[model samples]
Target: MSLPVVTPGETDTYEDPLDLINEIDELKKEKDASIMAHFYVDGDIQDVADYTGDSLKLARDCTQVTTGTIVFAGVHFMGESAKIMNPAKRVLIPDMLAGCSLADSCPADQLQVFQEQLRAEGRKFDTVAYINTTAAVKSLCDWIVTSGNAAEIIDRVPKDREILFVPDQHLGRYLMEVSGRKMILWPGSCMVHEVFSIQGLVRAKRNNPGSVVIAHPECPQNILEITDFIGGTEKMRQHVMSVKEPTTFLVATESAMIHAFQKSAPQHNFIPVPGIIASTGETCACNRCPHMARNTLQKVRDCLKNESPEIEWRDYFQQARAVLDKSLLK
Candidate 1:
């Protein structure tokens, strides 16, 4: 069943944020539910979540959830993922409208058409999709990967078969460089990551001397080129935590990601690299994903309390589940 979209502003009825938190806590117990939040969500939602992490971490962590209901405080694809993993439990998302641009870029039908075209030319290829894709898209893929595990999974693919990496061209390009694997890349990118300004990054570095720039691979080559360290969200956290000395980090991913970084290593300073509007060349805070911001404390409480907008098991999920198990579980 399709879920009704809930906006962040729609859940602003609560007078006290503390009261909403308490209500959500109480509702979780009453409904036998667990909330799994993505790190990209607001800090308040993350604080209230039973589990919080990057996509790969959350995908593995949700499988271990014993709750009767799972409220995913992220985007729609995440809700679908949780449901695919735990078909026995009910999976609910705070906002159905919280969609990923990367996922939307590669529709399942378009992928199928492209694969057919490649096959007609006698090209043998295996599809490797980022976990940000829809379940339908996942079913079409031979392997699923997140930024954290893409390199490892890419290594596992047979050397003979051509690789078709979808839905994030920047990441696909980066993987090709690191793994030395040539891939037919689907031209897609994360809306947030693609917008980060190279000019802003240079300015930030100049302003904060000795500050290290850590970027996600999803970022364009220009951004990743100037970065000191490049990795996924979990890896970024590990990189920062490993440094014993107090340091400033210019983060070149989603701005909300800085919340997790700050919480994990409060002693260190973290700055978000500003994005630029290409039309105007003005610096803006476009690094924050609008979809991730759609999830709110009020919506979490409402979803848990109502439990109407739940993710239903799909026939295609069985196919996707096999890929997820092979790609993520091992």
Candidate 2:
């Protein structure tokens, strides 16, 4: 796929970044497009999105929207999900290279081999794929789920059936513990979520006493153990909003979500969990996903203006819908 062309070193040098937002809005209207952004994208992208939420929510919105085009302001898999939902609509992403590390972990061929081995062993099982996967990997699964509905969807599986949970071992473990159902887990992880330094988090907590710790289930066990609340993005926001008492929170997810939380609850303080300390004693910017950061206002404007970087779904993508439609939510 050809992406919008901007000269090297031109990403941050938009003549006026504010003007790009206006241009993007005009293009959206002219193209009859709606923007769907993930919570982890840049704050400016989120601000311009017609719908901004978790993966599942954005996919659902894509199916429901009457717009002829869907401009996804997040990562590549997210754009693919929107394409899966609306096969005929034009789906575009700001950056075609904005990929997910978790999605990269499970190749379709590897999953196919695993499934074949399971069947050869007389194991009849259902596969549950996290939404953070490639369209090809998702096509291989019986059901697709987000962290918010994973446990609920998994519970609906018959008690006698074995299950395979993929593309995020930490999330799989969390589901296994919560639902008390054992399953084979694919060893995959989000780089940003997995690198949070336990030492750094502990230190931050001690320094900011009385702060509640909120973490995504994708975090490691050590992070979860110290977490006051563990949930998906929307659920985390709801938890913070539900509490009337003003409280400080140490968040252990993508740094961009902190911006959303602060916007939702400006009265409360939200500090991101620092990454592992370098030899210089400085923490890495591990809380941010480099892929997510690939998106910028300049890219958005250029993609919308040119209408390039459109996602094209293969025939298998269409076939996958038959299996997906049989599962709960399409």
**Which candidate number maximizes lDDT?**
1
Tell me the whole-model lDDT of each prediction, alpha carbons only. 0.91, 0.85
- Candidate 1: tens digits of C-alpha lDDT, residues 89-153: 99999878889999999999999999999999999999999999999999999999999999999
Candidate 2 lDDT score at position 133: 86
Q: In terms of TM-score, how similar is model 2 to the real structure?
A: 0.93
What shift in Å separates residue 88 of candidate 2 from its native position after superposition? 2.2
Question: What lDDT score goes with residue 114 in model 2?
Answer: 91
Per-residue alpha-carbon lDDT of model 2 for 103-150, expressed as tens digits? 999999999999999999999899998888888887888888788888
